[model samples]
Target: MDAERGGGEAPAAPRDGEGRFRRRAFLVGGGLGVLGLGGAALVAGPGGVRSAYTRVVCGSTPEPPPGGTAGRRQGTLEGRRVIVAMPRAARDTVPVVVMLPEPPGDARAPYDLYAVDRYLAASPGGFAIASVDGWPSADIVGALLPHLEAGGLDVRRIGLLGWAAGGAEALRLAAQLGSGVVRAVAATSPDVTAARAPLRELVDIPVWLGCGERDDRAPQTETMLKGLKALGATTEGGISSGCQDTAYRRRVLPEQLAFFARHL
Candidate 1:
């Protein structure tokens, strides 16, 4: 996969361990508060919705921290179910990242469990990462935001990530929310046309556009990337592997999270 920095032209590869260091920084200092000894607790909400509040500790994982309890809490936003992961420390306000999953099926599943856990554990400052079973609806996310804020998430530092149709929703929401709140966005194989126009409105937001090399929508992703660059938005990441493929997410998500760490 080819990853490029913002602007119309591509820059040379990062020298030495710069790229690696950035990734490590994302895992270490990515959150809103400095890491410290803390615990996580699940704050149970109504109807089986889960939410978590944690006191973050230093390093990549949260278990090493002493004193704070760790767990997930269930909660609902406008009737939509969500899964949230809180960091180990909760003393300070923290940023929150929302990952919009693919549409639901017969069985309900946790959203981005693997990625969310990894991010929260590695975050230097605690971050509350949440996700729903379906697309990233503005109404749903908007509702979720308050609940998370009330639980200690810093609404000011927020990020959005989505897959496929969910990806389009992230872009649309970023445009609607504007730079005031949304700091970064990552959309994989997004149906670019579904995003509302005034697409130029996203010029100020840093977007990580990901698509599979074999995806039919690759052209759309390319088109959107070109348009974003032309409009002056900082666009990073180009394509991964697979065509509208889920396997490619593993390759793309870390980069997206790192982008969010850089901006949010």
Candidate 2:
């Protein structure tokens, strides 16, 4: 099943002062810990520090527009629902980032939880966001790429982003698809043990892995980062203030989107 709707105009880019503030806050909050750079991990206790960090990084979370906002499409592929958000300023054929939401999160999570549509709108050289419900699989991608390409999205350059279990799935799928197909991947609070792909498969693909400093899975994320670096993979990430929840994911989403924009 497939349906398309017109989305509202893309939001304006952040002002110079706001952009500078966001960059400064990100650095001060220790959010720049790129994995391969040997940067120190950032840790924050609950309450004030975490709350302030969240506010600075995420700003205000906007409510998703009713039905479909501008530059958005909805469809079902391989029996799973999908939501594709494009930038109003997109070219005839734009690259796409495929989002695999955590378990219990559906296609709407990217828009509802992280306000990805707004982010997409602000991206300079805009790309499309394809958020999928349930686990990501080759079968789904096999069907999804064609569907998106038919709609004028570029299928050659692809990126992946995921949260929690979905994060692990993203890594595994990136390896499965290989670097030729996947340009980059970003994951938040991923369950590394669940990603069984051999490390060598990821060497050519840029991987960004992040998790909340207080999350129990932070150690696993750190370990995964180290392993990826050792394998010569282009990887970046670090621990932030919150735990494995929506707020933390939202805090790191901008960086993830930036990573996608840079490499995809």
Candidate 3:
């Protein structure tokens, strides 16, 4: 489970915070006993993924896409029933984050936010933090298309933050959404070469890609700069510091939030 990128001679887990993050990333949610609340799903078309995103686990249970578990509605993606959590608080045109989890059965769950939230727990400039679940990274965002618009969200300020599956999901949406999503951040995200043909579509928006040097799953640090370059995106790529684990050096998530705040 929390191995090095590319699955080579991975190093041992450090006793520092990063090590804890990796361990948490892979198995946090697995240990939890989740209670199904009859989720609400919104299905979309046939989506694609390059290399899958890193699998990290959070202690969160699967719920509907609106960000809460109270009243569940039914949605579909590719005709598959989808469930989303209803947003907890009342928001008027709130900036939202669309997150996709790694494959459900994959070693890594979609809990990358457990680590991301540690750094970005509070919203910047009163921006409310919200994430929607999808069949994959792409499916989670399908709800945002029109099915869930009544939430009164400000689409102009929507920022996408995806880990492995979610990153690809966000990228897919970026290819289609045009300027709908103001800013994007991909953490240990896949490259365009592995994405669909639309990967070349230009975003012209501010995007950031981050990966650990040891995270071989995708471009550890520099691949995103190259990929976004082709897409004509105003983009930057770099390694994240402050990671306690040497195998998967971490990019400071706060920097990611700063990028979102600055651009979105």
| TM-scores, all models, native as reference | 0.65, 0.71, 0.52
- Off-target runs (Cα >4 Å) in candidate 1 are 1-71, 105-115, 123-126, 133-138, 194-198
Better of 2 and 3 by lDDT: 2
- Residues 193-228, model 3: lDDT tens digits: 443424355456677676654445444336556666
lDDT (tens digit, per residue) of candidate 2 on 48-141: 3445555454443434334444378988877777789987876578898888888765889888777888766665546889976665443557
Q: Count the backbone clashes (under 3 Å) in each candidate.
A: 21, 4, 28
Give the best candidate by TM-score.
2
Q: What does candidate 1's lDDT look like per residue over 1-264, in tens digits?
A: 234444456668897788875564444333321322111221122111111111121112212223433346667655666667677776677788777766651002323333455544554535666775444333544567887788777888788877777788788888888888998888888866624434687888898887877778787788888888888889998865554543466556556767777887
After TM-score superposition, what is the CA distance of residue 18 in candidate 2 from its true location, in Å?
Answer: 47
Shift in Å, residue 154, candidate 2: 1.1
Which residue runs of candidate 2 sit more than 4 Å off their true CA positions? 1-70, 136-138, 194-197
Q: Which residue segments of model 3 deviate by more than 4 Å?
A: 1-92, 105-118, 123-125, 137-142, 145-148, 185-187, 191-199, 218-221, 230-232, 240-251
* Candidate 3 lDDT trough over 10 residues, lowest sum: 42-51
| Model 1 global lDDT (CA atoms, 0 to 1) | 0.63
Q: lDDT of all predictions, in order shown?
A: 0.63, 0.74, 0.46
Model 1 lowest lDDT segment of ten: 46-55
